[model samples]
Target chain A: MNLLLSSFSSLTNKVLMALAGLFLVTFLGVHLGINLLLLNNDGGRAFTAAASFMGTNSIIKVFEIVLFAGFLLHIILGMMVSGQNKAARPSTYVVSNHSATAPFSKYMFHTGIIVFLFLLLHFFDFYFIKIGLVAPPDGIASHDFYSRTLLLFSTPWYSLLYIVCFVALGIHLNHAIQSAFQTLGLNHSKYMDAVKVIGSVYSLLITVGFSIVPLFILFYRH
Target chain B: MNFTLKIWRQKNAVAKGEMVTYAVSEISPDSSFFEMLDALNQQLITSGGDPVAFDHDCREGICGTCSLYINGRPHGPLKGVTTCQLHMRSFKDGDTIHIEPWRAKAFPIIRDLIVDRSALDKIIQAGGYVSVHTGGVPDANTIPVPHEKAESAMDAAACIGCGACVAACSNAAAMLFVGAKVSHLALLPQGKVEAAKRVQKMVACMDELGFGNCSNTYACEAECPKGISVVNIARMNRQFLAANLLSEREKVVNISL
Candidate 1:
């Protein structure tokens, strides 16, 4: 225990970061699935049903606790590692080259902060109302999650912010999935290419999947 | 070929350093990078000026002593070769090559382009050895090792500890250097007895020395003079995990008993 804690080995922090990141990846899929129900044109019926089920389900309630904990841990650890990385080089180079490093991967800290700020605004808009801290929009059912989403995305500025954040998410997820696997010691030359491919596809899916929603609301909301 | 050199200059460890530009002409294109530096130093001495200081030993690349950051790339633009092995032919006439010391918190500047890499020595002292009986060397075939495993271990063992990995890393991480050492020993049967303790101690020393965490940037593997693979880093991680679990199990058993 002393060795583990006292060492505070980068390996431990990295593995924990990767685990939390992968867990959050799963959460994104589920969250996106729930949010996509907004496209049901009949009404907010399907969205409301799904949101209500999630809001009321005991298992999901428990999972939400784990989800938030994972988020908190990942954010704190990411900052810690990033801070150390910065401190490791007290002096700046006059001419630095990073041709070997991935372009999108280099902006990890930037993308992470963008995604974090976006999460805060997103939670304030939706989760707060669902949890009763904030009131739902006028005349909409309290549990009509879809209508509330529509109300938020209907604002041009807000919809644009969502699109921008989803793009940042795409960049973050692109590097993160493969990075997590590499950190976990799951990398191999034979399959690393495949892992990177899967990462890009997954990132594209989540980014496009979530981005299309707000665009549809802004453009097609009749 | 003639060229201008922008070399980092510092009077002492505590002094602030800056790049000082110098010119050299009539340099033979076939000379090694250090030979070009030697010619410049001779000129500086003749002019009664302070000669630029740097580290080099056994002008052959194997010594791991000729550490240099030329034109923003460790060991210059070439791959899998140390600065000592880099010849002037790799550069063109009139190209101003920038030479700086390996920059990291653990590696402080001693003078000019020379840095104190003793911090890495401390990491090595922490575990980079197999404790065995002092006697006649054992027969090579005494320990039966799988061919592939032996080959992989040798590959890891090729790390020359040049600190180029630290200089090249975006995060200034030394994981590649430390990982190569750990995997090299951990793969061999002779090193198994102290494998767990070696990794733990080396890692503790590495963290304490102010090295950064590896973020999978892989700049270390790319800039490594020996071309040490990033796979060694993953192997080290696996070894660390197993060691920690084994130690934890042992502690639990002791307490229960």
Candidate 2:
């Protein structure tokens, strides 16, 4: 019975956490490449082609279901884990600060919230419109979705929002990426340092890469 | 240096507690926090009040008994230190310092600041020992650990079984304490035979004690008086995951064969 419980517990949360986290990290690399298309002119031929392929691809649809499950599982497990944490230490923290603590620990829930909002915006954006889940709001043409993304960037506020969200994504990735490997028992310092650098670079690329789309459309869109 | 203290006092474990105020005048700034508390107790005796009860031993910081949440920080806002080593000089004249026991469900307070930290002792008992037989001492060099490995082992061994890591953790997880114990044993040649069993046992004990899981918050490392590394926690994870997988695979192989 104990073995059963332990095995189940490990598989449900810890194992899923690792798998989802690694899967999401892959999405960062691919998504970054796709996002870089905003650098193109002529109302986003590159953007539309990539968007259509992603939208119509049968394999991506299956992955999309998995992605959705992964997102919910990750968020739910994160909360359960945090809640368990709060229950264990019911006492209040008195330290004004602890530098030895990782920066990720403090802003965990906050970053999770920001990332969730970013996903919602992204879904309403390409997922909903591109896939026909819902027509683009404000009579925005389907082909003009790229231009819509560009025009949204025309407002500094919209650009600022994406930049801020991406920054949060970067911070979240900084801790999450390497943390996944640690969970998977990859703790050797020789290799872990390389993982940290990879995680940091990947996080930076995705965040900065996605944020740049807004800046490009805001500045260079003709 | 005279000082006023707001100490958290509870009649018993069943009762809810609050910060009952006390004044300890003419305190020597050089005296450790526990010594300052001793002075306050002396005054309490004279005034016909209950002496404040807190845990301590060895006056040195090694015992991990003197856990305090000074001001708003564990072990008094200082880094890489414990409550016993904390001096009155850390506080100023007329400062309203808050004192409380380690706050956790697993560590029930017996009275005042004295908590039943045997939960930690229980964790150690689960996997903290080696299975040595009754025999004469082996040769000094019979099992020689490499310098680097021995040093690393010693680093983990530096843990004094203190529950400060639990207090410092937002989740009140005992991962650092458990990690320290696991790393100390798992790295040495003497401990390899039992590494898998030790980690599985210790981690199970920790979880059973109602301590939370590790989230790599690294708070335990920060508040630890020994500055026990978060790397130790990672090491512990590696040990546990590898042990479970290896043991499981062995069982499967045996069954198949």
Candidate 3:
């Protein structure tokens, strides 16, 4: 409707971006749950089975489309919002602003860019193989994600990059979960502390949970 | 206390500004920050130099007129106080203090440390009011308000519109100022009459004024002289969402009709 379109402003853009980000957050949890199956001690039999199910499921296929859409929308709107925010101050201050805000809050865009670059590397290692854009390494099937993940994490530099990216992802999500709630108008004084606590906990879980897999592969799996 | 001041100096709104250094000696630690500046101005006038221009009124914190980004902090190093109330005692002797105006596209420099904050006034003019008819004063307690709601409304009403929030924000956003105003009214029964329309119009005006979006950095809450909470911003966002999505509108008639 014209009335609806007329009301779409910066706030609306933020709300949409927050919704997309929250969607990606949920996807991260689901992905981590699936990835943790790599530690099943059955030589990745369980992990590969689950990865195949996720790759072939009809509903998940549709969700894959939505997931990519969410990522693109979140990235595009984030760029737009950051651009406008940068333009709001035409000149730099002689002295740096020293407000006692959370240190990571201002660097959301920076952390987000790091996470995005990591996502590209991750897709090249895994998703691109699944979609056949990149060929799987010799003797590994395209559906054998567990082997591919183990192969990637087995390299010291690759594991280091994975851990570093997970750290950046953690920092990004630390502010992001609560920020998304605030942007969506779901925040309140009564529960805002709880939201912040939950955000920190979730970010920690994702960072530790994912990083543990790489360490486990590199150290114990060998 | 002897101190060197690195103050922003500009001839007028259109002129380029720079950090102009000056030395002030024998300032009493008991003197307020503005008084120390007054002494510097006196010395400058005697020497036939232009006095640094800054905004101040009421000498106390209530007027919300005084503004300065001293040492990278709005209203100097103290928390929950304005520049007018900040004393020279907060700084050490021989310290060089940096002072500048609020930096934002919506707030242009008027002189040296004085910025034109009329963009805030424009936001207020958009819908930051109730459309009450002029009449005899209504009796108290005529429309009952819950105690908690009234308390919350008063807390939000403490915003001084000093533009410190805008200065403190990385994005130069005015959400805190506008949020405080919107929440201050939206919580009360008198303001409830036009709450939906008020939020919509005010937000439209804010976006058009070239102020940035709130990224939830919370620097506004930290640097606000009144210690206005970011909860008010959340309340504003809630009001804005409800207004745009749920508020029913009257049917529009064609001009010919």
Candidate 4:
């Protein structure tokens, strides 16, 4: 493993980072699908049943470990790559112009940092409770993510922060999906434009899909 | 036209650099950017001052010898043309232009607005070549290259090895330059013989040269005087990944043996 890592070039590092990030992208889709069950109007029964299955399933336990590893690799590689990139230019131009590229491309690291902070909050809210780290709110079962999610979203401030983080995640994904395709060399001239469009649409869907739950809970559930 | 120029001035590679402002007047708008610089240099010589040192060879823009970061844009504000081809008409009278050297760890500044671009040549020396027997030149259409392949190869071949891509990239990455070099040759039959080895060696060299990783900003493509597309970068990525995978698999086989 050490020999393999030592032999990997900068391009290889980027490829690995892109692969990890794409995995996380797919994971977000699964997470959103499960979370959408919160709105089944069945008083948390459907959502809790699905959440309980995910928590207790043996396969999902293995997948959870893989998911953590993916996040760790993505974050570590992202920081290393960005640090080296910064060091590559010892000096900066007095007048810098980046008008030629997408405005959000240069800010991926910034948005990544924001999303990371939000992840800490999210894990504290839910993952910690699942593992008996933090006690579930009064009278709610430790495994009952459904009531916990609604309880948290019912707070106006918490819902607002959740929506804000989703926006940041959306911005990050707007560049990340297409960038991963480019990094992986899957981009072709004939289809690159289409890939870019798909990336935008996918990001928009994730942002809106996740934000709707909080908005629906705060407005309708209350 | 008259203008104020804030040009970086460095005596040598080890010397500290600073932006020194100068004024030039009564310049024709039709004069090339180099002509304007020449006028300024002439004035400096007559006034007992050191003339600014800038690189230039062919005034027609093909020779990639000239490099300047003018008013924050590589090769001046014009697209698809080198500094030698940029005219003074692009700027208005009394405009204040900022001129600086290409800033990259790989391409260190040699003097004011001039950097040592031998790093690019080193990458080329790594593998950007095709091995053919020394004999009479082959017939033109012997390989029977597809029209699309030839056209795309030509597009990639248009890169002039100017470090503008490095200058324009926020990370100062040379992926575009290396990608163009790799793509032009890799697309042709003659180059396919060593495509795997070529990409591996060049990429290794690029990484060792302190260049940054590409983040897909496409700034290099936008600032490239030849209008080289980032698609060449994608091609290089594909080539590098495939080459590395094959070589790694070979390593596993060798270990088993």
Best by TM-score: 3
The CAPRI category of model 4 is medium
**lDDT of all predictions, in order shown?**
0.88, 0.79, 0.92, 0.91
Give me the runs in candidate 2 sitting further than 4 Å from their true place: A1-12, A93-99, A138-145, A191-198, B132-136, B248-257
Clash pairs (backbone) in predicted model 3? none
TM-score computed on alpha carbons, candidate 1: 0.94
lDDT of 3 at A176: 95
| Residue-wise C-alpha lDDT for candidate 2, range A52-76, written one tens digit per residue | 7877799988987988887877777
The TM-scores, chain A only, for the candidates as listed are 0.93, 0.87, 0.95, 0.94
Q: Ten consecutive residues with minimal summed lDDT in candidate 1 chain B?
A: B248-257
Question: RMSD to native for every prediction?
Answer: 3.0, 3.7, 2.3, 2.8
lDDT of 2 at A204: 87
Chain B in candidate 3 has what TM-score? 0.96
Tell me which of candidates 2 and 3 scores higher on DockQ. 3
lDDT of model 4, residue B222: 94
lDDT, model 1: 0.88
Q: Mind giving the per-residue lDDT tens digits that candidate 4 earns over B1-257?
A: 99999999999999999999999999999999999999999999999999999999988989899999998889999989999999999999999999999899999999888899999999999999987753576787866899999999999999999999999999999999999999999998889878999998999999999999899999999999999999999999999988877654435445553
Residues A112-215, candidate 1: write the lDDT tens digits.
99999998987877788777888877887666677678888889998888899999999999999998988888878899889999999999999999998988
Off by over 4 Å in 4: A1-7, B247-257
lDDT tens digits by residue: candidate 3, B39-91: 99999999999999999999989999999999999998989999999999999
Q: lDDT (0-100) at residue B44 of candidate 4?
A: 98
Candidate 4 TM-score, true structure as reference: 0.95
